[model samples]
Target: MESDYQSLFQVRLANYDDIPAIMNITREAFVKYQQMSGVEKLAALEESYNDVKKDIDTKVVLLALSDGEPVGSVRVEVFPDKTAYLSRFAVKVTSQNNGIGKSIMNLVDKIMVKKGVTQIQLHTGSKITSLIRFYYGRGFYIDSTDKSRGYVRALLIKEYQKKDC
Candidate 1:
């Protein structure tokens, strides 16, 4: 069952040693995103090791591993206003559709909720219907769209309910 496959993945906070795996996964995943979105290049693809290192040092960077092999990664920066920005969410091409992405996202939700983040926002190509649907299924809605990057990028927002303590 899917649950069994999902159980194979373990999500944890990333450290300095994870930078290479993180960079590899991001490049491999975003190269596919570029092809799918018909864009020649993406900022994700241009990120250097230093950029990833900076994130690991300053933000909530998570790495998902399967049987001790890196399979996915995501980064989130929680701000002073109780809002969080999610970026570079990518699962390995071989690991896609196996519940790894969902697992990582569910962990993000739990982490954000614990941090009292009421709203989480991310941007993806607006025209990518499958991705849009995925986010929709995860409780995100299109807050707006912008073409500043030469493509219609949708700003998706997900708001969490404050828990009664």
Candidate 2:
């Protein structure tokens, strides 16, 4: 099943024209987070086109497409210390459980590795067990937790092994 999906799915760096698709997917995906965390408003849900465009200009923004249509998206910014911060990762609700999220993440790892990023970090609601498990399965581990957002948000980190080549 995963392989079948992979054949039809493609991940690519996003461009200016992709802002609309990215925004749509983010809203569709993060609404679930807002509901699960009981947060009435989220930064992801409030982003405007300019905000996404700025991200596209400064960060690594990617879109996951299935048969030429956008279904998922993610953004990551790599810092001077070779650490990257991932944000706005989302797969459409209709496309969940189809291996799209995992595929996007796997591509993220490969892209970061090529960029010499030693670690990648992201935060999510601690109570989202399924999401936590998904991160764990993708080689991420909890580094800490913070309640500054009125709910526990777990900081997860994934470290890449430097190739000896």
lDDT of each: 0.93, 0.94
Model 2 scores what on Cα lDDT?
Answer: 0.94
Candidate 2 residue lDDT tens string, 1-165: 676656777999999999999999999899998999987668999999999999999999999999889999999999999999999999999999889999999989999999999999999999999999999999999999998888899999999999987
lDDT of 1 by residue, 6-51 (tens): 5556999999899999999999999988887877769999999999
Q: After superposition, how far is residue 91 of candidate 1 from its true place, in Å?
A: 0.4
Worst lDDT 10-window in candidate 1: 1-10
Per-model C-alpha RMSD: 3.0, 3.0
Model 2 error, position 28 (Å) = 1.0
lDDT of 1 at 3: 61
The list of candidate 2 runs beyond 4 A from truth reads: 1-6
